[model samples]
Target chain A: MSFLPQLAFVLILGVAGYILSKRIKFLRRNIFLGKAETRNDHTDDRWKTMALVAFGQQKMFKRIIPALLHLLIYVGFVVINLEVLEFILDGILGTHRLFAPFLGGVYTAAMNMFEFLAVAVLFSCVVFLTRRYVTKVERFQKPEMKGWPALDATLILVIEIILMIAVLTMNATDQILAERGADHYLALGPLFFSGLIRPLFEGMSLEALHFIERFAWWFHIVGILAFAVYVTYSKHLHIFLAFPNTWYSNLKPKGEMVNMPEVTNEVNMMLGIPTEAASNPSAEIGRFGAKDINDLSWINVMNAYSCTECGRCTSECPANLTGKKLSPRKIMMDVRDRAEEVGKSIDAGGPGLEDGKSLLGDYITKEELNACTSCNACVEACPVNIDPLSIILQMRRYVAMEESGTPAQWNAMFQNMETSFSPWKFSPSDRFNWAEKVKEEEM
Target chain B: MSENYKVPTMAEMAGKGETPEVLFWVGCAGSFDERYKAVTQAFVKILNKVGVSFAVLGPEEACTGDPARRAGNEFLFQMQAVANIQVMNGYEVKKVVTACPHCFNTIKNEYPALGGNYEVIHHSQFLQQLINEGKVTLKGGGEFKGKKITFHDSCYLGRANNVYEAPREVIKALDVELVEMKRCKTKGLCCGAGGAQMFKEPEPGKKDINVERTEEALATGATTIAVGCPFCLTMMTDGVKNKEREADVKVYDLAEMIAKDMGI
Candidate 1:
């Protein structure tokens, strides 16, 4: 009967691991739905970017208050995992404080550190909840964050708070049990925060205290495992994706848009320049730009998934600030939503990519694409280097080339450019007309 | 201006088997936009005064296809790019300098993929280099000494190419107090003219981006607002006009300020 608890623990671990691996496979398949593009150059730069931007949380410092608050939670999350490692081992072996006797004093010191971080994490989570609810930070209150996005953020914070409480309660009860000379409850020195809460449990029967301690331990471990699975479906995926996303970040000057080599080949043929052996003469020409999620590069799709819905991109977007439809945050969210929709359909063997919906028209609108100034503010503002502007431009290409849907003014400018080599219909021969003013001033 | 201040053309120079130190790519706005023509003239005067051999591409120069690319017409953009590359390569042009950030960015960054590569420099960076070389000198803070000026960063020149310091350096050389807007450098606001927005009316918005940006510049309380890119020159000039502060607040390109300071 004692081994039944170990069997249950093993079953739980097996189930959680299976679900997590399945979800990871789903994520990988969905991200690879995008077109292939090489992002593996500049190995040294990629590592440094991943280290500084993702690991160091460098860009978060752009806003000091949040950066400090976030750092506490981030450090706590990393440090407390060590305590979790002991919890896992104890649960699997049906032993208490598995590392306590092995390391002696070091175990007590580490417990104290974890306890302090737990309090810090608890405190930061409350402040974050307050920012999202009470004070209502502007970025978190955008139209794109109205429903699930807002709830997801709140849920994660609340979950962390409960998990921290569970940790402290378990520690406080275990301390009481140890003082009462109970078996399996080691008397590791007092943990500062948890010790303060030990008084409430002092009067309980040893059996009741043991029940609460075991319940809290199970609650904490199970909560952590559930969180690991839940993170894949939430914006909290940034905890993992930020590393790979930043590693493959665009390294060229911000102004340099990716060149379309296919367009280059076509233009070369039209200009009668000896082109590299033409793509099979009978092969069908591909669509000019992204009409659906798959038309974008894999990195762009990954960027969509990696977004943490922070709304930093939207807040910094000039188009959004000026009341245009182009919220870059919304663009990323739309891509991710469409990707999820198509990915699920493919999983169900439903008509995928032919479901009469597309990323351009159904998810994101032409108004949003048109409103972008191609300014890199949104790109600069993203903490993980998500390039919504690239997606915007690609969709704009679809509208212009596939549907001939550019605004009337742009088409006029295009005609002028073709006829006179300028956006205005001034003669090319008079290109140096401004120099006449120089001569006139000289006279 | 002296009669000796004649702008040479690449065609004429090439006919004589001569190559200038740099090819001055006078962009569409610098050629046709009436307000921006003054900027072109001022930069030319500075280049002439410095004795830098520079020639314009004249009729051979076409649009750099930046607008088409940003507007999402890749075919049109590459068509224009191929035509321009053929002409420049034909002339063996090696270096290019431009006063328009759009042209500078497109030629410097985008052209290499299409077989057109040249050492491209924005006029702001080029002017800064000239000042550092002592080829251009300010005489006792020539007309606007100790006056308050704010340098507006062009999105393409500053954020796009990371050339924030050069224009500011040139402005400080005028001995003017360079006050900065709340948004400057990497955080600089766009002038509502990039991405071919200059050719079309802005989408429905509560206010124009230029007005918002101009409000920030005016809040700095700088009397003179100096800019480097021609698109910025036109947008900010109109913005000052929109606020009806044209008389009290003047928007001048960096080259115009330097030319006035040198008495050229």
Candidate 2:
């Protein structure tokens, strides 16, 4: 009978791992679907950034209430998972409290800590749910968050609450078993948080308590596995991606934009400046800028995947604050959604399915993209260093170069810049007139 | 020409086989806009008073194409950038200073990638260094003393290049009260002239960003609204006009303010 339970646990673990790995693999491939560009400079800076931003949750601390609550759940998630190792071993060996003998009295201390975290996790989840549903935070209620985004956030919090409850109930039942001195039940001290709830089953028979304990164990482990699989598809992917995303963040000065080498080379050639031959001789002169996911840099796609949909970027955006349609959070979400659609189509059709729709027009309107001031506020506000401005600039480049659809006034400015080498209509020769005038004024 | 008032060009200086200490990049507004021309003259007067050997690029100077690049016309931007680069390189120019944040930003940050590298400094920063070095001294109690002066942070200067202190430091040197707008420094709002918006009409909105920013300045009860960039000077001045507070509030660049205080 013990052998059967162990075998079943092993089988379930196998299936969950397989499904989770498959989803991870799909996500990895989808992110790399964009064109390759290097963001690998400043290795030392990247490491420091990852440590500060992701591990330290430095940016999240800007809002203290949410930060403390998030830290509680985050610390609980990380530290409590260490206990999962013991659970895994106990499942495989058909034993209860397998680490108890090895740990001596420390086992009780460890269990106490885990129990505390479980309670904290449960508390944080409830507060998060209240903030989402009851408080109805403005960032969480934007139009882009109406459907799956809203449901996804609620579901994750619910899952966390359920998992925490299972942990507490399991401990409570195990304590009852230990008191009864039942077979395979070690008589350990009562856990701090769980001990309080242990009296609920005061009059239950040993057999009934044993059944309840077993059910609690199964529910906790199964729910965790399901959550593991579900999180790969949710914005909670930030739990894993945040580390890498923060590590690969742009480390240069915020004002400096990424220059397209192809455009640079073309300009160098046009100016009759002798340029080196093209690196990829076979590569044709392609469209000037990004029209879809594949045209964007891999880092941009990674940014999409790493989005927590927090809307902090949107809230901080001056354009969005001023009632423009350009929400930086929605820009990231649309990219992720488009990437998912393209990834799914490719998976279904052997990587050759042509989706006629694109990120522009069908999803993000030109008005939304044009409304951006390139202010770098979004980039600054992202808890994970996602550069929404880069994506905005790329799409604007497409509108300008491929579609020739810039506003008429902007086009006029461009024409003046080309002819007179200035945005003004005057000749370059007239530029010095102000200097002489300044001299004449001084005289 | 009077040695005290003459502004030499790169071509004139180069003809004498002499390179000035810095190249004064008189930007489009400082070179053309009538109001900004007074700002340019004030800055020039200060430079001359300080005996700094700075030469203007004059006709050789072209727009840095910051407006073009920001407007998503990369081709035009590059063409303009390359043309200016060629002129600067031909002049064998080294250090450059500009009173315009837009030009300062594009050259200091963007020009490097296109093979135009120089020790570029905004005029406010240069003026701060001059004051620190005691090159220019204020004539005591010159007009601005005991006046309520509030500084507007230019988007390119304050947020883009991290140049908040230099201008404020310059203002504080006049021994005048330097008040801050509610949204000053890093959290400063754009004066709405950035990103080529100065060259084009603003998109339809409930209120202009400059107007909103100007209201913040007005609420400070400042007699003088100090600025560092010519763009911010124009926008804030226009904002004051819109509120009919032009007589009550005057917008002056940091350079212009110092020149006035120096009795230039």
Candidate 3:
């Protein structure tokens, strides 16, 4: 297994994989380097989350076809890991099948399973591409989607399809060699192609085929490793990130806002939105709300990176669906882009680490925040449980509390909330007046 | 037919804690909005029928302070909370109940921090129990068949307080056919009325959310939109009316529907 060529290949992949993984982790960690939104007991719902999120994909099914495609790809992605291993083992271990002994005899079953999955996933990826490029889901139509990530995804898809087909060919060759007593224990779809190779084997047989198989074996092994390394850096990072994210999602009610600091006392505790906490975050003495990514909690940052970009949240968002200024996906992405800017600044020691402008500035326009009805449909439909409502409410609180800035009607409502104890400014004395009019049997 | 319901102000009691058989906090919507009168009357009627001797402190009950607090007027919300606690101490009211979901949330979830703690129950919950216990009966009325209807689950009563079944139970008890909206129960849509938005103009959505909701109900072809909260009833009624389907659809509070079925 320590052959010079194989070692060199693995070493290349290992280092490249390590670098990209660390860089993304670094970017994700620093985006919002504050506290988490209350840790939860994962052990309690781990199985439930797995059942619902991993297998059931209950959230994804909100949109039928895409959900089905995603499920197939997810399962295929998991099952195909075996093929990659089979390639490596056949190339380096000098065998066409896994040699775990007891596990070896089942290679026919196992290889067929992997091959079947590869076909399914390939088809799934096709449907996914159509959904993304042809159908062009609204979640992916953000102004930014025309940029790098979309291009990267298209390139990756091409590579995956080509790589999988090549490996499938190599699998066919393995079947031919194995049937001729060349030692591969697999024979399923591999058998059909292997049967074709039988004619060549009929006259001058195993030795020539072994040499051909050896070279094909090396190409398949290296190709897989290269793709594996590329995924760590590409848009495919969510492939690794989604599981951990699903585990740590905010576990509270969608309408229930987080408990914030009591900037002013005696006004009782501010329940829903803050009306007067911090004003100008750009100010030197400012204790203002989040103007950018820096002020958000670590979990909020995670929510951004944790985004699978599957677009489920944006698809379910009533605002986005109705032509509003809010695409929950875009809002999170903008926050993330700003954080990446800050990360670059930190690396260069510049004036970029969340300066004066608040989160209410252009990034999350007031129109977008106001557009939400706090209905939480997006939250319910999110595969990773990102609560877009919480972010919207925070912006609402910052605007309401510190700035006291909003439309005239909202201002009036605030005034009424102070006087009427209800937003309508109804006189408290007439509170029971409604009861006087009810004829006891009006129903 | 008429009684006083006052929310206790802290100054009235000055000091000392008192607990009564039950605290009658008349929620602002129940108190000031005459449109919600049937809900209040039905609740009172049901309470009496169940032999739960409840008293109304007409002026003693203050606002539960949910709106004020949610609207960035926390100071006012606090003052109201303190005053209610003081009044409750004076009346010796230990248990609290109200027809309004807003009042239920403020009293049960928000009051403990300000020393205004008591066992609180929404009237929908209480009345549902009464109906279940056979204390409240429908008389001189048979099962009147109507078009299918959907129930609008209020945020507070449904998700916040986990009181999803009671209102639906009341609706099911009626012989009218029922259909469900795409979003119901935990995933129910808000009427653009919670979080003090009731007093303010909505945030200018492309589609008026209530209308969107009413249309969703209309899509189900339900003749009536049954609701438990006064705000939901008011907003949805206005929403249905604005869609020019006012005659086609009517929003009825759970109490009004229940009281109608029973010849009280």
- What does candidate 2's lDDT look like per residue over A1-443, in tens digits? 65999999999999999999899899999999888877788889999999999999998987799899999999999998888888888888888889998887899898999999999999999998898889988888888899899999999999999889888888998888887788888877668898888888767998899888899899988888899999989999999999999999988667776666677777877888766744444267777777888888889999999998989888767667666677999999988988898999888884521577888888888788777776677887788889998888888888888899888888888887677766877787777777665565544
Q: Write the per-residue lDDT of candidate 3 for residues B1-264, one digit (tens) a residue.
A: 534332233333333343335555667667767677667776665554455656676655667666555554444556676677766755656788887888787777766665667788877777687778887765524433555879988877876667888887777777677788998886677776776667666654467667777878888888889888888988898888888988767888877777667644
Tens-digit lDDT track for model 1 on B46-152?
Answer: 98888899999887889999988889999999999999999999989999999999999999999999999999999999999999999987884576799889988
Give a tens-digit lDDT track for model 2, residues B241-260.
Answer: 99999887899988888987
Rate residue A124 of model 3 by lDDT: 79
DockQ of each: 0.71, 0.54, 0.30
Q: Kindly give the number of clashing pairs for every candidate.
A: 0, 0, 32
lDDT by candidate, in order shown: 0.90, 0.84, 0.65
Ranking by lDDT: 1, 2, 3
- List, residue by residue over A5-63, the lDDT tens digit for candidate 1: 88999899999999999999999999999988888999999999999999999988887
DockQ of 2: 0.54
Error of 1 at B249 (Å): 0.3
How much is A443 displaced in model 1, in angstroms?
Answer: 10
Docking quality tier of model 2: medium
Best by DockQ: 1
**Model 3: residues >4 Å from true position, as ranges?**
A1-4, A36-38, A41-56, A61-64, A82-102, A135-160, A177-238, A261-289, A355-358, A438-443, B1-25, B55-57, B60-95, B110-120, B139-146, B159-163
Candidate 2, residue A281: the lDDT equals 40
